[model samples]
Target: MSDVVLGVDIGTSSSKGVLVDPAGKVLASETREHHVDRPHPGWVEMDGGIWWEEFAAISRALVHDGDNVTAVGVSGMGPCVLLTDDGGEPLRPAILYGVDTRATAEIAELTRRFGGDEAILDRCGSALSTQAVGPKLAWVDGHEPDAMAKARRLFMPSSWLVYRLTGSYVLDHHSASQCTPLYDTDARQWYEPWAGDIAPHLDLPPLVWPTDIAGNVTAEAADETGLPEGIPVIAGTIDAWSEAVSVDAQNPGDLMLMYGTTMFLVHTVEQRVSTANLWGTNGAFEGTRSLAGGMATSGGITGWLKELFGSADYPELLLEAGQSGPGAQGLLMLPYFAGERTPIADPDARGVVAGLTLSHGRGDIYRAALEATALGVRHNIESMEAAGGSIERIVAVGGGTQGDLWTQIVSDITGREQLVPSKTIGASYGAAYLAGRAADASCAADAPTGSSVPYAASGPGVDIATWNPPSHTVTPNPGLRQDYDELYDLYRQLYPNTQAVQHTLARRQHRLSNATDTRSTA
Candidate 1:
């Protein structure tokens, strides 16, 4: 049997695992779907136990009793805050990434305390937004003192898996960078003063590169997962960075566009580019930097539309959407159902469907939803470019990339061609590659030092370009560009045009929801 590596990723809506050989052929794959828990508005969370449970299940289902799986790799949806006790019991449900907007007050308080948005951005490479882990930590300290008292350690999904599997507490530098104010992007270490202020009692893990060998799976973990007793495990980064690795879009000017429950954009830059509009942080590998932008909703709007339409499936919707043509037949949507993240970090922002008419059909609405996501992508790209991001190429990945209509709309709106890779297996595949690279290096006695890549089949090391290359390019239609440009202008204006109304309704929604919950309890 060929040596293989098992890669598992704990995602937002599911956990996915893939077994791959040294040559990157996927041997087996498994998925277990799950969802986040929202007990209150602006609060999205998941039981931390679910992450480990899913990982163990996926491992057992993928690796056989006697399979020669040389290594294990892990990735997850993060910069999450999972506060655990000394013995590793979760104190509370893991506060998820940016979508969980419960930290708004904490964000403002910290921003003011840290000398302002520019100061924090200059030091931490990201502003104190919902995305920054520091604000979330402060929120916990202020709100959940009972949990905070018992919180002896902190862990994200990947780090949590690494701790469970190898008994080694470590977090990748890339993921650490996302813990803004808690980590110094230049120093690549925990920023002591701010970390002390935010999570004083928590024992932070050692920082390692995503490709570094975290440790070997212990005998206890082996018993649970049915893998080799001492197989190596590579430290993994966040899902988006791993997705970038999967497509070999880590070089400067390479912008990775991830479309899923949420839309994420990672633009790798040559030098550090800090901006309040976008997230600036260290890359997956050393000496690399990225300006990242995330939307709280993308496919989320389309999914909601599908559920509302009830009769039409994705394929049918895609067909009708394509037929509806550019500009969505005089329909426009804001795709801010969950609130906006990058560029405009407003949690009160609500979804807006403009240009609605009795004449418009479901197909036109669906097409408008698709176009809304595309326009958001354009907005993020524009923000990135304005902040000194050189986006020369866009590589599209994720579940949204499975269908062509979405990508086509994005290209048509942005007037930029997008390259889709052969194997868009995403974060899990990237984790597997890192696992393979680590296993190869461990096997070789003469591996070189320095860069993450070593023992490459060609070039310097295990490059993703060798494993997966662009299968096709989605080119923009020149004719649609003029129409899209007009709509894009309106899309940008619609938010500020109706910001006060959105916020007013958002506040009323909170009051109504609270009353409903109180009555339900009574």
Candidate 2:
């Protein structure tokens, strides 16, 4: 009977679970695919119940082998707003992170109320934007009062799992920091005045480090998941941070590039840093900070393309994309299908494909999409460096990293090397490591007699270097740099040139939707 830790992650398109031994070898893994609901444009949501259901399913499957499960770790896509009643029942489907731009008006109102963007950034380490939980909370309060009235607690995917597993209403410091205006980066606590103003009726969870032991799983949770009672559960953070941990990218000067439904970049910095273009917040572990940026779409664009192409798998598309080469056969695309996020933050922004021709095929279009995301990565890297982040190392993670073509395109476009780790199971693996650290006897013994123990001891903990190391590096091809530079310049120009038309079209779309709703009601 080998001791194992179970890590589960609630992702945008799926829930993943991994079972790992203390030595970091994966014993079992499971994934349950799911999709978010888009009832209205810019509105992305998932039923909170789905998270728990998937978690239980994944857990049962993973634990079926009778591996002695020692601890439980959890992570999820976030800074989401899952408003729950006092008893922890969800009031509405959880509003997802950045991709859901339904709170644009609420963002503007909060920014104005809080003395503008700069002040909010200075105080909260982030400006009011789609990524901020406060705006989403305010949006609910304004638009759905019935749901708001029932909401008395806030839960992100990670926190929701923690609450269900341990019966502890706790949020990790990293996740809490993203609840901009409500969390003070300097004070490292919930800013009461701002929190009261924004979410007046709800009780914010107690803050804890992602590694801290949230609580032990009770008998009820054990029965549902086939896990032993009293297994320690960690206060896991967002999926991106967990992915960073999985790749050993938590150190200063390490930038993690996550390629998923949305592309995300997290640059760990030594001290607190703020940027109007990017998000600055507390890191997963204590005494660390991160500057983060996310593009609204990346793999999402490719997924759309796959569906549009009809019955073509990714390998077939990748082969075609490879043949299309450096400039995607003169096509340029803006990877803003879901609207841009970091460095742009334009919710009204729409996708644009330039240089289309009758000669172009599906391969060329797919190649253009890959190049578009690569260019977006370069844009974020430049912005990050401008904001005092030093990106000495680049680590790539997530589903998009599985293919070589995309990674090579990114490396060539950015003129940087990316280290792809061996175990790209991502956040679930990181959660398991965190749980293993929490279950370490040394971590428990070092704490003060009655004080809550830190999830990690005051040293190099959970040796990620050995657990997951770089399998290979993607190096840029020097010959393509000049051509990419020229195309990059064109890519930069295309957005501003078409901004007005895109805005008008977006407004028209809203108008048409509203008219249809009115007609249906009549």
Candidate 3:
């Protein structure tokens, strides 16, 4: 039997699993679609139980009889707060990353307690915001007493899967660094004082590099999922970092743009580059650092617009949007339907569509949505450079890269060519690569007795370039430089100009939602 590694990633809307041979050939891929539970505005969550269930089902589906699954790799959306009781059962639905804006009050409280945003940023690499795991822990302590009382373990989606598959409570350093005040980026260890302050009762998991062997599949888990018992499991990381690894974009000056439910930008840096708005953290492997940013929406806005357009599918809309041309027929939209993150961490920032006229059709609106995300990407890229990071190459991944329209607009708007890899199965594919590395017998043989080997060891000798090289490039349309420059300027000004009104309307939305809930109970 040929040795095959399994990779799975838990995402916002679905779980995807892929099987890959050591030669980088994808044998099979499986997807399980699921939805996040949004019980209240600004709150996004999911039952941790769903993660394990989806992972197990995907594993079973991918691993048939006679398949020699050598190793397992996992990744997921993160910096999430999934607390469990001492016995390892989840206490409540996990509080998701930056999109869940319910932690505003807790963010403010923790910032004050920790001296201020700058102090925390200097030490933690990222400040308190909806993205930080510390504030969410504080939120739980205040709001859900029952869950808090029993909360004794912390797990992100990837870490939770590791625990389920191997009975090892471990989190990747990349994910742990995003935990903000709970971890010190320079020390590469938990900041006990801050962690104790925020999560007094919770016992944090030990950290490992994403490639390190966490543990082998336990007999119990293998029995339930049919994976071979004792196969190694790599300590995987947050999905974006894995996505970076998948395309070999972790080199310094390489920037990865992920277009999915939310837009994510990750830039590899030689050393730590902390920005008040962007996340600065360790990379999946050691000796590399990353400055990361995310927009609350991207394909999300496009998908929502598609549902509104009713009969038109993405292909038809793209054709019409292409005809709408460079300016979106005088329409411009802020891609903050779920609220904005990075460069401007405004949870109350609402999406704004300017220059909308009665004559504007769905195509024009769709074009504006695409342009808005492109502009947002440009905004984050500028912020990254401003923070002392450099970008030499831009790589585009995720489902949005399937069409040239969106990637073209982004390049024309940003004036940077984007390299699209041959296989954009994304984080799952990257996870499999790491798993293949872990499964290399020489990796274990090369390690010192009772000590782990560094990820840079050439024993595995795996190179991602051979697996998913850049198959094509989207070059910028220099003809649109002047037009996009003017548009980008207007985009930068729109948020500040409408800040007051946006906050007022956002508050009114909260009030109306509260009233609706009250009436339902009445």
RMSD of each: 2.2, 1.9, 1.6
Separately for all candidates shown, the number of backbone clashes (residues 3 or more apart, or on different chains) is 0, 0, 0
For every model shown, what is its TM-score relative to the native structure?
0.96, 0.97, 0.97
Candidate 1 per-residue lDDT, tens place, 313-409, comes to 9999889888998888898899888888998999889999998999889899999988999999999999999999899999999999997889998
The TM-score of candidate 3 is: 0.97
lDDT of 3: 0.90
lDDT per residue for candidate 3 within 412-449, as digits (tens), equals 99999999999988999999988888767656523321
For model 2 the TM-score comes to 0.97
Local accuracy of candidate 2 as per-residue lDDT tens digits, 1-522: 877889999999999999998778998899999999987778899999999999999999989655888788899999999999999989999999999999999999999999999999999998988999999999999999999988999999998988888799999999999999899998999999999998788989988889877888889999998888877888899999999998999999999999888899999998988988899999998889999999999989999999999999999999999999889899999988888899999998999999999999999999999999999999999999998988999999999999799999999999999999998888999999888777666565233211344534443335778788689999999999999999999999999999999888888977887787788889
Q: What's model 1's overall lDDT?
A: 0.88
lDDT, residue 518, model 1? 98
Which regions in candidate 1 have their CA more than 4 angstroms from the true location? Answer: 442-461, 519-522
Which residue pairs clash in candidate 1?
none
RMSD in Å for model 1: 2.2
